[model samples]
Target: MNVKNIFAAVAILAATGSAFAQQTEFVAPDAAFQSRLTRAEVRQDLAQATAEGTTAQRQHDGQDTVYAAGGRSRQDVRAEAIRAASIRHYGDVNDTYFGG
Candidate 1:
């Protein structure tokens, strides 16, 4: 083929390929598989257990000593203290609102 014909053919193929590659719809989750996912309470329980485990591991590994020292900045310590106090006052604040 001539140069012009070859270039037109290539451009048409490229445009058609890209148009066919577009995704136009959301894929819904499988109902049965989704049902097996941890619910909010189960997630909270797992997260709490994981955090407790992490804290215990840190304590066992002498991380508490390092954490107590200058490893954390004054601002970080103050923030942690405020967070602890808030949790004490309100049990547990909403996870979304706690950080912000």
Candidate 2:
């Protein structure tokens, strides 16, 4: 192949390899909620001591948000986390969805 074609093929191969290789190490985004400026480094600090959950992303306050929590079961932690996320998104537990 010509030099230009070789360069193009190398570029495509590098791009694809990088895309697939990136999946080898899963790194969730930082669980840093904008609120709670007074809290510790991350959301895990606020989770109940005995609870066990994972950092996850969700839509909150018109932006992407992340949180971490732990509980007796994964379901319990997920439910609580979602509720907290709702509060962050809507400003109140009872806020109507249409309002936002």
Candidate 3:
């Protein structure tokens, strides 16, 4: 390699190494840290929040809180899915149906 190319490569590597070396380090909390609330008090507060329906609720994908009383049942949905799968085309339409 030429002197300029070797020097450019070294400079780029040095810059990257310096940038990585100057990253911030993680510092742990103090050993004397204490909680303001007791375990029993925290538990009671959590229970009260849960009873009042104020706790955070995580809904999974495709799930919602609303309920439909007259919705389709599990068996109905499964049968419909099976029927649809049985009639679904798994091959090319033009090649299978036409003389291609």
Worst 10 residues of 3 by lDDT: 91-100
Per-residue accuracy of model 1 over 6-89 as CA lDDT, tens digit each: 999999999999987856886666644555456897788778989888534443754454443478788999999999877634
Model 2 has a clash total of 5
For model 3, the stretches where C-alpha displacement exceeds 4 angstroms are 22-25, 28-33, 61-100
- At residue 78, candidate 1 shows an lDDT of 100
Error of 3 at 66 (Å): 17
Clashing pairs in 2: 51-70, 51-71, 52-70, 52-71, 53-70
The residue pairs in collision within model 3 are none
Q: Tell me the deviation in Å of residue 58 in model 3.
A: 1.9
Model 1 misplaced regions, further than 4 Å? 1-16, 28-32, 37-44, 51-100
The RMSD (Cα, Å) of candidate 3 is 6.2
Tell me the TM-score of each prediction against the true structure: 0.27, 0.23, 0.45
Query: Judged by lDDT against the true structure, how good is candidate 3?
Result: 0.84
lDDT of 3 by residue, 4-82 (tens): 9999999999999887775387667686788899999999999999999999987677766797686889899999999
Clashes of each: 0, 5, 0
